[model samples]
Every structure is written in C-alpha cells, then in structure tokens.
Target: MRPDLCLENAGRRYGLRGPWVLRGVDLTVAPGRLVRVEGANGTGKSTLLRLLAGIDAPSEGRITGRPRTAYVPERFPPALPFTAVGYLTHLGTVHGLSRTAAARAAGEWLERLGAAAYADTPMARLSKGSSQKVAVAQALLAEPELLVLDEAWTGLDTDARAELERAVAERTAAGGSVVFVDHDPRRLAGLPDTTYAVRDGSLVPCDVAGPLPSGPHVTVEAQGPPDGRLPDDVRRTAASAEETGPGRYRLTVPAPHSDLLLRALLTSRPPWHVVRVAPRPDAPGSSR
Candidate 1:
C-alpha cells in the first residue's frame, strides 16, 4: 500500500533552541485512513497539526509526503482581516488563480459551508462558529491531498457540524486525506479511525486497548481477583487513572457529567462489563 504521509522520530521546538512541544513522535497515515489527535487545552494539539501540515519544521526526525496539504486552525488569523471572501480570494490569487477564478472558488466554499451570507464580512467580525466555517472553507478550497484541521469544530452548531463531517467523508472517498483536532470527543465520534491523546509534550494513541483517563472518581475492587479489562467507553471518558486498593481501580470523572457516565455503564450492549454505582457514598461496598 502507498503511504500518503510518514513521520519518523519527529520532534519540534519553536524558536532557536528551547522547550519542545512535541518530542519523539512517530506516525503514518496512508490513503483512505484517518487519524485524530485528542487532548485538553494547551496540550500541543495545534503544534502537532502544524508539524503535520509542514507549516513549521520539526527540530528532530523526518517527514515525507507530497505537497497535498491544507491547514485550518481554530481561529482565523487577524492578518487575514475580517473580509472572509477577500481572504480566500487573496489566498487563491497567491496560488496563481486569476481574480475571477479566485472569486468563484471562494464563493463555492462559502456556500458549501453555509457561510455564504457572511461572505463579504471581515473574518474578525464573524462569530466563533462562522469564523470556524471560514477556516474550513479555506482548507477545502484547493482540495489538497491532505488536510489538517486544528479545532475545526469548536464553534459549529449541530447542522453545521454534520455538513462538515459529510464533506470530509466525501473527500476521503475521493482519495483525499485529513487530520484534525476536536476538543469534544462526542463531536468526533463518527470522524476519525484513530484518536490520539496529547499531554506532557507527548502524543499517544487513545481510545484503543485501554480505558480513558477520566472517570467519575469511581473505584472498583473485586471481592476476589479481578479479571479481563475495563470497557472502552469508560476509558475514553475517564478523567484520571489511579489504583486505589489491591486489584481495585478508581476512575475520576467530572462531577456534573457523572450521570452520563453511569448511564453508559448500565447500557453495555453485549453485557461483558458491568458496573454497580453505590447510590450513597456512605453505602458500604457499592461500586459502579
């Protein structure tokens, strides 16, 4: 199979020589496959996307790919000005598109992303969701072989989100590739094949073969020895991971979203994993 992108032992540190945002990273994305990077704020998610897009050079390691890439960041740059249409038209012109052709491309992307009405508005003047839609449009305008979206869905509503998802799916179907970051995993549920967690200046695969790092502060202790493993849903949404007692585990989750976590626990379809949340904290020997 032909590999569309390859990074070997990649490391990046902004400035001449300082702290590194990404270190010892290795990844490969072939044609027709999607990989996601997931993490909390300030976890180098954007830095990683930049590295993938070749916007910046990696301090160490190597990247091999054709010049088929598009990058869409969370917020459009102030330099682009508030004129979203003009921004795209100018970008297209830089790529050697004539004014008329540039206007045509910009118009099509604006309509496709549902930001047609906001076409002439300056990007700085657009709302968060609208501005993000502009960024999406910018990335997809040229239809690069590889597209990188950084926080691409942060500002979109439900319908807008669905439209963007469909667009990406269709692109992949046509032999294009994409990589993007999403703050909310729920928004990304149907988007990526592999989700990566970024933390402590590192990027690692997440939501595969292990539990998520966040939990509702629930710990499990078997009366006897524990067996098998925890479910993927628990792992993906787990807040933190800590071993409490012997053969017992505790998962901390945001208190407000505790019920959603519990509901997921109860509704395991195959029924392989079962958690019992004790109704009262004071209750003896209760678990979920």
Candidate 2:
C-alpha cells in the first residue's frame, strides 16, 4: 500500500542567509485525494510543490514518506536531442518499466493526449502545445502513486485539457494522490478534496469553493455501506447531505462537484450505490 506523503513544519530558502521562500508548512497528501495549491506569481507555489515531489530538500524541518512520484513543471525544456516519443520512452524506463513496455505506454499516452502525429518529431521542433502534451505524457506514463503538476495545462488546447482532467480523475479513483497548481479557478473547480493557499511565506487552508453561481445544482441519491457510513471526501464535497432512510443519503452539490462526489462514493472500499441523479432547478440561470 502507498503511504501518505507528509511535510512537517517544513521551510526552504536559497542561500544560508537568504529570505525564506516557504515556511511552517504542514501538509499530508493522502491516497485517493486531490489537493490544490493556489497563490499569485512568485509566492512559492512551485517551491512547495517541488518539496512534495522531492525535487528540493527543505532547509529546516522534515518531509517523510516518499512514494513513487512524478512531476510536470511549468516550463518543459524542448531542446532535448531525442524525439518526443523517444524522450517519453526513456523516462518510462527510468521509472522501472522494461524497454518494450515503456515504448508501448509512451505511445498510448501520446495518442490519448492527441499528439500521436508528433510522435517522431524532434523535441525542439514540436509546437509549444505539442511539447506540453509530451511533458504531460511523460509524468503519467509511469502511473505514479503521487503526481504533482504545476500549471500543467497552460499550453494545451480544449480537447487536450479535458483529457488531462479525465486522467487526473482516473488516477485518484485508482487510489493515487495528485497535487496541482493552476491559474484558472475552474480548472478543477469543486473537485479538490482540500485547497491551500500560500500567504506571506506560509501555507494556509482556504475555501476555494466560493459562493454558488446562478447555475443549476445537482442532486444525488446514494446508499452507503451497511453501517451507514459515508466517506469523508463524499461528505466534504457535498453542499448538504441528508439521510432519508437507513444507509441512504440525498446529497446536494453544485453541478461542477457532482462528478467528484460521485467518484468518492463509488470508489470507496465497499462502494456506495447511487440510486438516482437529477438536476436541482433551484437557481434561475443556465444549466451547467
């Protein structure tokens, strides 16, 4: 089983006397959870993610539980001598896959991200969007237990962006953990199990789920285990959950969060049975 990645009161800085980039950070990336880190430019969002991915060591405190990890940085270097597929294949082998298996997985991810046409193109010759696709593919080719992404969607087109989201959902549903940073508030919207913000060189919990929009909401009816217990993530994501009968629940959540809530219920150990799903016409705006 994969262990939770933990950062306990961690701090980092450049030089011995340099100012701290991040400090007093305590975070735990648990299995099957999605975490979001938010901050303006130069607020150490990337630094924090680097710590989580083991790319950098903390200047103080400690980080423990290093799971099999992969990371996609904000900028991907495109000047490598190898072709896109070759680069990904090389990375796959480094992650412990055999040469044949690595090449096969490389091809699959490239095709899924709609970049198969550029498979043999030199890394430096590919377009920015195509290069970004290669970068995303390499991180996912290994099926890592911990995935860290820093603005991994910046250069992708609409279809590629949607494909990455689906990949993230699949990872978490398969009992992997993911942490990401994106500029768009709606990137994952209501899907994150927990959201944190970097403020004044510290990590702080923040409510990313702002006020409800004037759009329609979703109502899900599900039945939990025989003990009538729901997963913590399912309860946290729902706006309101009421028990109408034993082991049965009616959950109301914003439309954007419905998929995440359902994933939590259905992916639980014993799994929750969904009875029905319908849109709540409480809001007077367009459907989501």
Candidate 3:
C-alpha cells in the first residue's frame, strides 16, 4: 500500500546556494504508524514539518502523503480562552468540516484536553499550558489522516501530556498516522513505531539502546528533589544510559536525543529513578 507520508530525497536551504538545511531525506510514515524526526536546534526539524504539512514545498524532493495533514509547531500560536473553541471551529471549517461537525469535533477534543470547561473563555485569559492545549486541539480538530507534531507538548502540564498520549493512541489505533518531531522519545513511552535522526538533510535510524529498536540511550530524571518536583511543562528533560540490561523497560525515541526532551520536561518532573530508564545497547548510527 502507498505510505501515508513519504519524503523522497527531500532537500531545503536557507539562502541562495549558501547552505542547505536539509540534504536528502527518504522516509515513509504509513497509516497506523508514526515516524518521528529528531535533530538539534536550527536543523530544519520545523522546516521539514512545514514541508510535510503542505504549508510549504520542499526545495528539491517530493513529499507525498494523504491530501490533508496537520502540523503542530514548536512555538505554539496563542489562543485566548474566549476564542479557543471558536478557533477550533474556524480551522475545521477551513478543512471543510460543517459548522455542526466542527462544533462537535471541537467540543469533543476540547473536553478530552480538559479545556471543555473553558470552551467559551477568551484566549487572552487562558494559561500557557491551557493555550498550548488549545493549539494542540486546533491542529488535531480535523482528525486528518496524517498528523505532524513538532513538540506539540511544549507547554503542556503532566495531565495535558497524558491527554496527548491518549489522543495519539486513539488516533493511530483507528488507522491514522502521526509524524512527531520532538527532541526526546522517552516522553511518549509505549508509543512511536519508527524514529529517524535528521542530521544535515539526512534521515538515518536513531540507535536507541536497550530494547529500543534503535537510537541513543537517553535518561530523564528530576534535577533536584523528586518529591518537590515541578510539572513536565515547567522543567521538562530526560537522559539515557550506555548500558543495556534484560528485564528492563526500554523504549525508543527518534533523533533529536533524550537530553533535549529531558531539559524541556524538567518541570514535568520526569522519572528520576534509574529503574524507570532501561539501558541501551548502541549509540547513533548502529545497526543492531
């Protein structure tokens, strides 16, 4: 079957023959699966997402996928409380959803995100986490066949984080696809079917250690006291270990790396206990 999302030798640049942010990326995100793209800051992670969302075209290769796709950016767009549901309705309409369907879809997801109480609130009064949830809800309102999220959890709290996982799980289980671009894969444990490390326009496998299919070993721990921990949104971050062990709960994430996700989740209060983080067998670029 044709993949839901395909990047055929995709390439992009910032200037005129000066530097290409992305070189040649070959990848496929199929239905009922997610292919995460990881990389460092300014590495075109967001750029690649843009190309895939149909917002922009790759300078070189072709990005093929379902006709409609959704993108959740790293820097979330602000939505006041009062404008929240209305905004969702607006986006749904743009996607060709009817007023009633848009209202229903908006209400359902808003409730799922725990923002239903503020359905009529203005965007200006919503908290950062709340607004981020709105942004997430907006991107996902259409329930497009393909969803591309770039750090969609950027400003969400722990509860909101869980909500995201639940949404993705439910979405994909119904034969949908997700293309998530986050720094660390550990944040969304029990998720992600395939991961990719984006380095200079190249898409390669991420060598997650332990039982992680492939990718770097990352660890996420509370920097300070575990009991008095902040939320993941406030101090989000994670880490990885070099060793691999049996009977350990190992998970795999794509390219951006665990450290980045850890830092972002510092406030989210990631697991500080070593027992939570299993060991990995390989670093980046490893086959086994």
Candidate 4:
C-alpha cells in the first residue's frame, strides 16, 4: 500500500530573511486522490507545487512520505540535448524500469500523446505544443505514485488535453495521487477530490459546493478475484462500492472516472470481470 504524503506546517522562502512564499501549509495527499491547486498569477501556486514535488526544500517545517514522484513544470526546458525518445527512455530507466521496458513505455506514451512522429526529433527543434506533449509523456511513462503538474495542459491541443485528463483519471484509479494546477476554471471541474486555493501565502480549502453542478455518474457491476477481494485502487476510486453477492460488487463513480475504473479492474494482476455498466438515471443531464 502506498503511504500518504504529509506536509506539516510547511514553509518556504528564498533566504533566511526572504519573505515566505508559502507558510503553515498542512496537507495530506493519500493514494487514489486527485488534488487541485488554484490561485491567481504570482500567488505562489507554482512554488507550492514545486515544494510538493521535492524540487525545493522548505525553509521551515517538514514534508514526509513522498512516494515515487514525477513532475511537469510550467515551463519545460526546450534546449535539452537528447531526442524526445532518448530523453524519455533515459528518464524511464532512472525511474527503475529496465532499458528495454523503458524504451517501450517511452514509445507508448509518445503515441498516446499524439507525438509519435516526433519520436526521434531533437527536443530543441520541436514546436511548443509538441514539446509540451513530450513533457507530459516523460512524467507519465514511469507511472509515478505521485504526479505533480503545473499548467501541464497549457500548450497542448484539444485532443491531447483530453488525453491528459484520461491519464490523470487512470493514475488515480491505479492508486496513485495527482496534484495539479491549471489555469482554466473548467479543467476537470467536477472531478477533483479536494481543491485548495493559495491565498495570503497559505493553503485554503475551497468550498466544493460552488457554482458547478455535479456531473453525471455511472454504475458498474463487477466480480472480484478468486478470493473475492477487490484491488485497493478500485475500492478507492469508486464513490460507493457495495457487495451485492459473494464476490460480486456494484460500484458507482463519476462518469469521467468510470472508464479508468473498468480499465483498472481489467488490468489488475488477478483481473476483475465487469458484468455491466450503465448511466445513473438520476444523474444530471441523464435521459430518463
């Protein structure tokens, strides 16, 4: 089981006397949770993400239980010497995959992000959108337990943005934690498990009952493994999981997470069998 990442009274500053960019931030990012950070420009949102990603150490307080982490910075360095595939493959191996496996995963992510044609292209020569795709791919190829994204969707086109969202869902479904900051208000609007806004150099929990209506939901019926045990990821992602019969369970999840939930079931070591899936009748925008 993955451990929860905790920040206790965390604070950061440039120097001993520098003003604090963030202070007294207490947060716990547990497995299978999606966390969103919101703030206006120069509000230190990026600084907080950097602290969470371990790119910067807090000047005061402490952060513990950081899992295998990957980060996508707001501005990707485009002048790297290696080709797209080369850089990703190297990073993959650093993340502990074997050479062959790393290369394979690198290729798979590039294709999924619609940057396959630029596989061998020099990182410096690629366009901003393509480079951003590479940035997203590198972080995902390793399947990190903790993913930190700072405006990772900024330069991508429409399809890639949607793909990234699915990837986020998949990560959480697989028992990983994702913390991200996006400029668009509607980005994953109804999906985040917790949302925090950076205000006055502090982390403040946002009221989830804001303006956006709860979106549609899906009901899934599935059979557990031979021992009638469900994977932790499946159990965590489902809004509700009920045992209807021996080894049989019904899971209700937001519509966006349903596909990843099914994928997690089908891809587990002792794969689960999905019996049926249907939209919830009472869900918003659902047809009677």
What does candidate 2 score on TM? 0.81
How many clashes show up per model? 23, 0, 52, 0
Could you arrange the candidates by TM-score from highest to lowest? Answer: 4, 2, 3, 1
Each candidate's TM vs. the true structure? Answer: 0.66, 0.81, 0.69, 0.84
lDDT of 2: 0.87
Q: Mark the regions of model 3 whose C-alpha exceeds 4 Å error after superposition.
A: 1-3, 79-82, 212-288
Worst 10 residues of 4 by lDDT: 279-288
Quantify all predictions' global Cα lDDT against the true fold.
0.67, 0.87, 0.65, 0.87
Q: Write the per-residue lDDT of candidate 4 for residues 1-288, one digit (tens) a residue.
A: 878999999999998899999999999999889999999998899999999999999999999998999999999998999999999999899999999999999999999899999999999999999999999998998899999999999999987997898889889877899999999988877567899999989999997554322556788999975466878778766766778888888887777677878988898877888999999744343111
Per-residue error (Å), model 2, residue 77:
0.4
Question: Stretches of candidate 2 above 4 Å error?
Answer: 209-288
- What is the Å distance of residue 244 in model 1 from its true position? 48
For model 1, give the 10-residue run with minimal summed lDDT.
279-288
Cα lDDT for residue 63, candidate 4: 95
The alpha-carbon deviation from the true structure for residue 173 of candidate 3, after best TM-score superposition, in angstroms, is: 0.9
Best by TM-score: 4
